[model samples]
Target: MVNLTDLLTDLAAESADVDSLVAPLSAGDWASPTPAPGWTIGHQIAHLAWTDHVALLAATDVDAFFASVTTAPDPARLVDVGAEEFLAPPDELLPRWRAGRAALAAALAAAPPGEKLPWYGTGMSPASMVTARIMETWAHGEDVADALGVTRPATARLRHVAYLGFRTLRHSFAAHGREVPTAPVRVELAAPDGATWSYGPEDAADRVTGPARDFCLLVTQRRHRADLALTATGPVADAWLDVAQAFAGPPGAGREPLSTRDTTVSEVTA
Candidate 1:
């Protein structure tokens, strides 16, 4: 069985990191735009805070959580609802976010084993729930970091995110109303600590090999597949790169593949 303790620990650390990084931002900074298209820094934080609160409810009191949620008439616009609902002065939003995240970390860590928690699109085990939270933190943290001109380095915690990405391949495919291919594809990633982390069967013909940071970036929709140095083989595997998403939701419009121009051989072969 997967250990939820380690996953929760990592999530807590990552959450704290995000909190510290965003703590220094001024009202002007929070109003700045992020890499997430039209979403501003405040919007990003509000989204995280709102989701954190919901996750806490799911972990601790599933019935109340369900009862408390008011479904929007338009489901597609639901993501926008949280931002609008949480719109407040920076001081108010910040404290709500801080409380929400802390509550989430505590609730998730205390969840009983074998319990399934409802999430955006599917139910998640405590381990999967925490991993998904960590993935969200790192993904949005990247955008927040980018807005602040800070480079967030990759960490071994990515092993869990990569695990989630590979595990969700079928979901990603199915979300598009397409059938998932059964043949396994190899995922060989170069971890930052000079170690190789791999997924899928060793004998599988399909393969995706690249730096770990790049793979995480690709799965999170933080970078277009073309922007990263990853190689895929086999038609199924090759096509998967065109639409890879870790976090669950509607089939996302993956970022556009960028031009392979002014590029070096190392960039391709690395």
Candidate 2:
């Protein structure tokens, strides 16, 4: 089992880093186009904050959380709310967002070992919550960074990201109407802290080996797996890459090549 405290600490650190990056941006920068089709930098941050709120509710009362909230009508509607939610002049949305995160942290801290909480149509234990949060933050952070023409600071938290990638393999196989591969694929992540984290079987038909950050990027669909130095030795490993999804949803439509230049916000919304 994973350590909840360690995972929470890592997630908190990454969330704070994401907030720091956004706090200094000019108003115009918030609306800059990110890689997720029509989402903006501000939209991405707001989505994170909103998800934290949902997580808090889910931990305390799953039925109410799902009942009270509705997904934004469409991608454009979601982006509008995401950009405007915390920026509205009078209310305490930012404070609420911060408080929600604090509550989420507290919930995780206080949870009994192996206590499962509702999330994304499944039950995740407190330890898994940290993994989910860290993966989400890092993945969305990449969207913001891609919009700004900047790269985020790499970190060892990416082990969590890689694990998320590994977990998604089962879903990927199922989505394609294939049996989940029983053969384990080895994963070697070279973390930013100079720590190496490995998972899966040592002598298997395939392997995925790369810097942790790049592995995170690829699985999240923020960057193409081919662009990184990651290798896949078997058909299952290659198939996993083609359908891997870290977000809560159906499998993505596959990756498209990213433009070297920053995409225009108008182009995305159009």
Candidate 3:
């Protein structure tokens, strides 16, 4: 059984990891552009805070959360709009994000058992919600790390991200307007501590094998498949690498490979 407490704890640690990255930054660093097009470090945190607040609403007040969805100015640009609306000076935005994530943790912990929290186009259990939070935190943290030219070691927290990525395979295909593959795809990843993390069937013909970090990067759309050392066997697995996405939204224009990029920083479609 999935343990909410464990997932929540990992979520806290993931948030703290990102917080540590930003907390030491000077005011000017907050404006540093990340890999995400048009999004600064500040915008990344703002987006996290905004999403946490919205998630908190989903957990505690379903009506209000849905109301915000219906009233959004631009559904397509909702993520950008949320980040923009919550963007602030470092001192202010930092605290806001910290408090919001903490509150979201508390709210998710106290949610009724098996209750599904309404999200963008679907609903999620509190555990799943927290897992998604961890995934997003790691992904955006990657952006922040890239902006600062810092290398973050892969941790066990990547398990949550990898799992979410594997689970969202169908959503990825649907988001790209492609027919979802019916074949099972096995994912075998080498974890950070030299352990293996396997998902899907043991005998599945379609399989993806690689370092866990690379798979997470691919699913989060943080890096292109060509940049990663992942091996995909079978046609379904091969096609998946091109369109894989762990996020809930339209197909993201992912980053270009290093050799193809005009500048040092890889350009990603907003």
Which candidate comes out best when scored by TM-score?
Answer: 3
Candidate 1 lDDT over residue span 225-244, tens digit each: 87899999998789788777
Q: Give a tens-digit lDDT track for model 3, residues 1-270.
A: 899999999999999999999999999999999887788999989989999999999999899998989999888888889999999999999999999999999999999769988998788999999999999999989988988999899999999999999999999999999999999999999999999999999999999999999999999988889989999999999999999999887888888886788423553322
Error of 3 at 118 (Å): 0.4
Where is the poorest 10-residue window by lDDT in model 3?
261-270
**Of the candidates shown, which would achieve the greatest lDDT relative to the real structure?**
3
Runs off by more than 4 Å, candidate 2: 68-93, 176-178, 259-270
lDDT of each: 0.78, 0.71, 0.91
Ordered list by TM-score, greatest first: 3, 1, 2
lDDT of 1 at 229: 96
Name model 3 segments beyond 4 Å from true. Answer: 262-270
Question: What's the distance in Å from true for residue 159, model 2?
Answer: 1.3
Q: What global local distance difference test value does model 1 have?
A: 0.78
TM-score, every prediction: 0.91, 0.85, 0.97
C-alpha RMSD for every candidate: 4.8, 3.7, 1.4
Question: What ordering of candidates by lDDT runs from best to worst?
Answer: 3, 1, 2
